[model samples]
Target: MKLIAKWVLSASALLFVAYVYNGVEVRSFATAMGAALVIGLLNAVVRPVLVVLTLPVTVLTLGLFLFVINALMFWAASALLDGFVVRSFLAALIGSLLYTAIGMVIDSALERLLVKK
Candidate 1:
């Protein structure tokens, strides 16, 4: 149930990024759903390995490197999905930033709402 909620949050964030970030657009609910799945998978698989591999840089940067990893994962998901196209590196970076920001917001909001209920 928590996992489902997490995915929904991710989907919502991706949808927002598509709307506000750049040329990226999720044409339908199905496309957004698919993009969410890919994003989750990439975060599950690629993100950990990336974090481990870049642990030194991550530590050196005072945890800021995680943002880069997050952005890379976002770009990877965009690359793997259809109907979701980031126009350039800058767009991808902004999209990635928005993805993280919105996801964090959604998660915290859900936590606040559900924990009280």
Candidate 2:
């Protein structure tokens, strides 16, 4: 259930990005679903590798480098899907930051509205 909630949160984040940023492009639900799959896969598969590879730098950055890994996953997802496009690394970085913010917001709201019930 938590996993499904997370996926829905991520899809909502993608939709929000599509709406707010000119640099983000979502062609259709098919593409969006593909992009979301890739994004989730990359985060799950690549992120731990990246975190270990950059462990020293991550420690140096006081653990904030996780955000960089997250951004790279977003950029990679953009590359994999034509409809879901991020214009550049910087845009991807910003989009990822936005994703975190939106996901947290959605999670909190879900907890309040659903779990409280």
Q: In model 2, which regions exceed 4 Å deviation?
A: 1-5
Residue pairs with colliding backbones in model 2 are none
Best prediction by lDDT: 2
- What lDDT tens digits, residue by residue, belong to model 2 across residues 32-81? 66777788899789888899999999999999888888889999999877
Give TM-scores for every candidate, taking all chains together and pairing residue i with residue i: 0.85, 0.84
Candidate 2 lDDT score at position 1: 82
lDDT of 2: 0.82
Q: In TM-score terms, which candidate is top?
A: 1
Put down candidate 1 lDDT per residue, 4-53, tens digits, no spaces: 88887787778877877555677766778888899888988989999999
lDDT at 80, model 1? 91
> How far out, in Å, is residue 19 in model 2?
1.2
